[model samples]
Target: MHLKLIYSKKELYFLKSVFLSKVEHGGASQLCYAKHCKDVLDFSASLNPYPPDISWIPDMKLLLEYPDDSYYNLKKAIANTFGCPPEAVCVGNGSIEVIRTYFYATIEKNDFVRIDPHTFGEYSLSVQLAGGRCTVLDDVDSRVRIICNPNNPTGSILSSSELIEIARSLEESGKLLFIDEAFIDLADERQSMINKGISNVFVSRSLTKSFAVPGLRIGFGVGNPELIEKMEVIRPPWSVNAFAEDFAIKALENLDLLEKSCELIKKEKIWLYEQFERIGINYVPSAANYILLNIGADASLFSKKMLDKNIFVRDCTSFGLPRSIRVAVRTREENLILVEALEKCFQ
Candidate 1:
């Protein structure tokens, strides 16, 4: 009698199906892929319009050597800027990578994770990828809760105090809370919960949004030493390239740049809000560097119409708001052009 034969990880087939599920993120990738990058005004990415100046050219000599797996200096830089010990920092290729590491470290197969709706899709996707189930509602049995602070798409935020309380509540029940503060540097760092020293709470941040260097892909997590150590052990060595490490250290040294960017973004966001009101475009007031608009029409069509004018905005269907679009707060010149394009669309 023949026994059942073992095969490759058949589980990956389900993972593949999960990957095939629809999820869209806005950036210049589409325009670049289509060879229309230069003339296109991209409002899809929510980033600091003005990034602090720094020498981005990496020393070729450094590239000749392998990056330090420990990234001691880089951790020191992050620790100084974020009020965490170097041992409390877990670095990743991007904040998303850090999210994946965290889930892998804590999530068990079939574990239920509580996730908010209409936020960054990555939270749900990452949990599912880690053999966990994601639920939009809070279930008594759920062990983890994910939140995108200064939330994407909606741009809603919870105060540091509000979130600290939630973290404590979860901690008492032997649960964990993960906050994605990727936008906090561009929103209000004073509202960040990174300094709370909550053992069961994890906060992930990225230079992608605040430093406007998505290509560099430097992101990190802050947590108690025990949790950070687990994630660090699971995170692959040399995951951060030489150039990204250098750039991230430089960006941390110039934290004041965030203040300047926030000031300018606030001014521009207000101007955009006024324009939206005057033009009869309904919009949600945002606490971050982006605005959510209610277009009263199919967002995909509105976005395509705007694209015809060489402007790009985020179609909200992927975010589960089919009648809305999200626009990034940009410079005065670009904002004017965007308003002009909108007027033409309405006409």
Candidate 2:
């Protein structure tokens, strides 16, 4: 008798996915590497440079008693922040969860939608997991459209007018529109679709990225009340940990902190862009917290080179742009290190 080993294609692909997740573990910030260097200015993640209000962690006993089943207060806070009704608000473990729930709620199996090229990969993955189809749209209309405002790698943002026109068209066509505004906090608030009052549109916002509370894993979505109700049905219970909820509540209470952080990012982003220009390296202008750059060729190779020098940046190979890299806007000193290093590399 002969025995044969069996293997499945999905299993094989899963193994690859795990191996090629991100340049760092979910793109960990450079600041965490204090052991390797005295100064770690991580421009890898677009987060609040200012720390949370508390000098230390808060107690979590109250939160452990199981989250508010209805999440009433949480929804109310979100509504207050967005100047909308509580019914128009929905909560999730993170914005990505809300994104997945939204797709699963409406998209029929095998239906196709258009997404930005080399944008966030999770959107496509979520569609596939829901057994739906994805078709890329090239500056053309004719398919359901999803976009990441101030997009992921390049950080390019679609103007409010353009997005409004697109949303109007999609609404008239009876198609779904999902816009991940997780990074839009880095820009002026008026540039967002939320200000335009567009319906049939879902905007997923996260405190994780903006408030540097990623460990809390709390995010919310604002959209049509009917659509949010649909997602709530599919959303799971206790998806948000207790401490995460508390963190969000406290963070939202401090409007001054939010404003200060946003202003700093905008200023630093401009300075960082000028640094890149002065260095004579190739980079795309960004409205978000990070900049996408070209490192000659083979970004993975360039990233490794930086890492060897105790510096790190995001290689865009995962986004299917191997020659480009994305780095967050960090402190002046850290930005200088990156600029000097890249100038050396180019020379």
Full-model lDDT for every candidate:
0.88, 0.76
For model 1, state the Cα shift of residue 264 in Å.
0.8
State residue 294's C-alpha deviation in candidate 2, in Å: 1.3
Worst 10 residues of 1 by lDDT: 13-22
Q: Tens digits of per-residue lDDT for model 2 on 6-63?
A: 7687555445445533323235444455464454445566676654474436676765
Assess candidate 1 and give its TM-score to the true structure.
0.94
| C-alpha TM-scores of all predictions | 0.94, 0.86
Residue pairs in clash, model 2: 43-328
Please list all clashing residue pairs in model 1, or write none if there are none. Answer: none
> In model 2, how large is the Cα lDDT of residue 171?
88
Error of 1 at 245 (Å): 0.4
How many angstroms is residue 59 displaced in model 1 relative to the true structure, after the best TM-score fit? 1.5
**lDDT by residue for model 1 over 113-219, one digit each (tens)?**
99888888888888877788888876548979988999998889999999989999999999999999999888888888887878898899999888888788899
Backbone clash pairs in model 2 (N, Cα, C under 3 Å; residues 3+ apart or in different chains), count: 1
